[model samples]
Target chain A: MITFSKQQLKIPKLQRPVYLVTAGQSKFDRAFPDKRTEELCIDSFTMAAQLLEISPAELKTYIHSCYYGHFADHFGDQLLGESVIHDRLGLDPLGNIGVKTGGATGGSTIWEGMKAVASGYSDCVLVMGWERMDEVPTDEGNFLISCAADKDWESPLGHIYTGYYAVMAQRYWQIFGKSEDSFRRTLAEISVKHHGYARFNPYAQAPMDITVDDVLNSPVVAYPLRALDCCLMSVGAACTILCDEDTAVKLTKNSKNKPLRLWTSAGTHTLRPADRMDMDIPLLPNETADQYKDLGERFPGGDRYPGFTGFLAARVAAHYAYGMAGITDPTEDLDVVELHDAFTISDVQTYEDIGIRPYGEGRTYVESGDCYHTNPNTGQPGKLPSNISGGLIGCMHSVGATGIMQTFEIASHIWNRWEEFHGDENIWNKFNRQKPKDWTNLQVVGAKRGMAISHAGVGSHVTSTILMDPDHLINKDA
Target chain B: MSMFGQVFVKNNQYKLKGDFHHMTPNMPIRNADDEWKLLGVTNPRAMTYMHSYGGEAVFFESLSQGKLMASRCDNSDCNITGTIYMPFRIHCPDCLAKNSVFDLTDIAKKSATIHTFMECQRSGAFNLLDKPIKFINIEFDGVATILMSYLVVGTPKFGMKVVPIFKTTGPTYTILDLAWVEEGTKEEQLPEGFSF
Candidate 1:
């Protein structure tokens, strides 16, 4: 009964061009002693401010508004962090926003910040997502997350977060006949690949040298899902500042730097119980129809429904990002991707959902190594190297913090800033700008058309497509 | 709906004596023949009467003890028979005028049976238990009203006979003195600790 018309749904048009000028994250860990949520937030914000070469006071004046995305501990007292940092650094803002979308809170916050800039409501906005889940006991933390689902029907039925994903796994097996062994192999490979990437990440929580065998042999928590298949419970924070193109130049010139332009971002919500639909039926205004109709038509099948990992809502969101970015071919166009791998099954599901592989063919993409860090089959290289920053498996999923972590990783990779800590220096140098020490050197390489996709662990699915022009790195392309 | 009327009787006089009064001989009728002749000779315009007395008085006087009891028809060929009584009583009301005899005893006091039970979570002043309570109905030795009370056992099972124990708190004379029943044998029970 409650619906929005096209005109009412339309967000206000912004006269100024927006750009993702800066992004930063704190060290991901299981717990930080004496670390409050506000401190973690301030830590992330301070890192971004430092990266932009601007004091919090100078940046505060430019920030028209601010949004915070967080769950678990210190939710009601979030302003304390903003006020503390504001007082310490002497910064003030015109408006502030807070979004709590269960586990997807971080991704939802990014979408909120993007909309605020795109709508011309504010010329610049600061967005941050942080969580201190480790402060509570594990069961209590899980209870908080489970609160996101339907309490009466789901929780009372002893449905944990894992059980929700387990149902999806069961459905996948029933529909595609994908055996548990195949799922295990794909999951193990995904975990090992992310862990290998994490070894290069200084902020990853569970960075380790794990193997496919390790993931397969790990203890099974739920049927078809082993211990390695699950993401680590992490405590950390991530932050980003968005500014219009003209302001970005003035600020860049004043600070002698470049900016990450604001690309198209899209978000959609499907019916809560995704399983209620017939498998063959198409989800309306899904990522494909909503964002990628042209690409859907271009494919030989003439608009086929993409089957995804039905666990997390991220797959649909990632698809939407591909569409909004006008990516006709993911294998040829997309250079890097980051997905919320809350569980191993999620990574496999994401592969199919994001159109990296055909329906029921995500396993092949993994086996072929196109979705891995190192391609063993082609000897050429993987195309869509996914969850390269160890993902939720290595990075730890502090429900509220994981989504933004994915965005920060993609932004960092596209900016060519990954090698400041990990990965091959020469390889990263190809994507890096000429000025190695300069912050602008973090820009994406030959990335005239770029897209970043993120799915919230909960039901809020959002895909953000960021289109950046190397020429416009210093100014607005439009 | 059955239309019925009641007329009270005190001694040998009809209490309803205003418009339809009746006179009776002071001498008591000693035999059924004399009682039938007295009833037949009553004027058509005279009011009829029935005597009613509290069951407790007869129970104490006849049985000399508090008891759970029932009533039975004294007629020789009556199919309509035994009906359970509460607080004990003498004489079956159904056959009182016909057979004119009554038996008062404590037959049920020697044994008890469980009828049914239910578990409940509601609790308050109205509930016997101050917390989540379970109610059970036991057909006690010689009482009616099923001796309803809260079950004291951790777990209650069907067909479990429990003997009723009385507590003298609040108003002792009231039936509220009857508390929960517990599992025990007749040999383990004792008479009222204090005289009523």
Candidate 2:
């Protein structure tokens, strides 16, 4: 008889000292008539290289692997472009990965990079995500997003992306008895807050100051979800440079900056529509709900189960990352957070899913104003400030690039470099009363840790990344 | 040829089996959510591929038809199918599919439905506009499949079922050849040389 040993039963720890040292992004905009996917990625790559103060050539040498996050054609050319960049820089990479995860492409790519580094397979990896929405016609884009749903059932019913989410939104209303006005108010607050933050983000796509009424009165795309409540499907790109610990120190020591350590990373998925029947209705206590339930039993656990979709995956992934990183209280332990706010409801749902609030209470977190960069309800200061960099709503979603963009934002905030590049003082002023001019002066706030949550819109993908201040590296003594 | 025959010929044809193992309430074994979770953690790459393919079908459906349509539910609620992707069946997708026979005779004359649709500017071959094409979910009086098609018009409103006009020439004589829609008023009769 063959038996497994306890030692073998354990999952191996990441051998390399991976550090998310530098991150960069391109300006997000509505798909322009002239832009192409290659151009967007090239621009994002250039920005990423510039931020690291490294030439494309230097980056090539250190990059053991590369992953592309996109959902467009020209897959061959996209890979060739990376190779050409490497060859031009005189660096030979061992592996090249071109993975597409619908809207979760960016975050998925980042997770892949982190996995490569964590698995002791590679020392340094470069993850790039880009999308050129303007290159295609509007009908085509709609078709692309809709494709994310069940083509046989939902597609046959003419269920567009918004309508799909609207059904869920409507179901939530039925169970919670929340009025359309309440949903609108919550969405408006989120949109307005993110827009205000976007004013400082030069790379953001649709930055505007609008009232709650604007959101309420916005064209109803699908009943409760107004135009403003939804995120803009724009074109953009983002890149991150991750390396092992020794390499990070060597590079940082040689440079003038500190590196952001990779605390942990995780991803999870749940049931699709067909599988929903096996799920329990009225969501029994300790019994999680999948994507489907009888309309009558849609809202389970009331305040305990937040109505937002796609949190199960995110929450599961976050649990693993927190456990790995030794983080117990995410709200108190993490200094900053950035979530995939594809829609206003997503942000609220994510809060509860991530354990920040008790289910139905996500709205209270938003309404009480404790979730914002500046707290309104309690003058005493908020524990966690989420999506401060405008999130997907303000930043624009380039499908595959959206997840990575959220990760990059969280990494940048933790590193305290957003103000330097964007020249936006609001984030610093709101979070840090007295802004520090340089990275060193930016006090390592209360916690030396931070976390990020990313999810794909089709309601299938979820990933979480934990970033720790390099100073808090647990194995430094080793 | 009739609209039904044309669509069947134009789009890529594949047979999806109902024989595949499915999660049902009686089984009570494992749920789709559990399977999704397992797949998500253990096979993220596959999940990504699944989603990417889902995105691809949207473009395929649009270029095939000038109008959008969805499948009707054959089960209990008669509610339209929401997020369940292709090859999976759970009953009624749109108002129950039982005893319902779809006819495409009046597809060209029916007004387009806007309640289920989106404007897409990415994916597939065509790049006619600066932004993505306006994809609409049009429900006609005689079709079982809610045709997913493109809207030549700028903005679409709910309950508007515009008529589909096909292109004169194309390798595949699919519904997508029905290139644009005639807006403002629903056509009372079929065009010349057309039959129900």
Candidate 2, A1-478: lDDT as tens digits: 1122455333235655568877777667884434445556666666666666777667666778887677654322243454543343344546776767666677778878877887777788888777766644565566556666655434423335765566445444434435446755776789888876776666777767778888778876665667787888788778887888776766555443467777445444432322222122222122255433333354442432222333556655665666566666667667778877877766777776676664555677787776776576766445677776777888678776777787777766666665565665553353232332332221224445667776765456777777877776434531
Model 2 chain A — which ten-residue stretch has the worst lDDT? A276-285
lDDT of each: 0.54, 0.57
> Model 2, range B49-116, lDDT digits (tens) per residue?
11223323433344344433232334445343332222222234334343222223244465445423
On the 0 to 100 scale, the lDDT of residue A27 in model 1 is 68
Per-residue alpha-carbon lDDT of candidate 1 for residues A112-211, written as tens digits (9 for 90 to 100):
8877887788778888877776644565455555555543223322224554554445445434433456655766887887776666666777766778
Candidate 1 CAPRI-style tier? incorrect
Which residue runs of candidate 1 sit more than 4 Å off their true CA positions?
A1-16, A73-90, A254-257, A264-275, A279-323, A421-450, A465-467, A470-478, B1-196
lDDT of 1 by residue, B69-111 (tens): 3443445654434444432335444345232333422343345
Docking class of 2: incorrect
Q: Give the TM-score of candidate 1.
A: 0.60
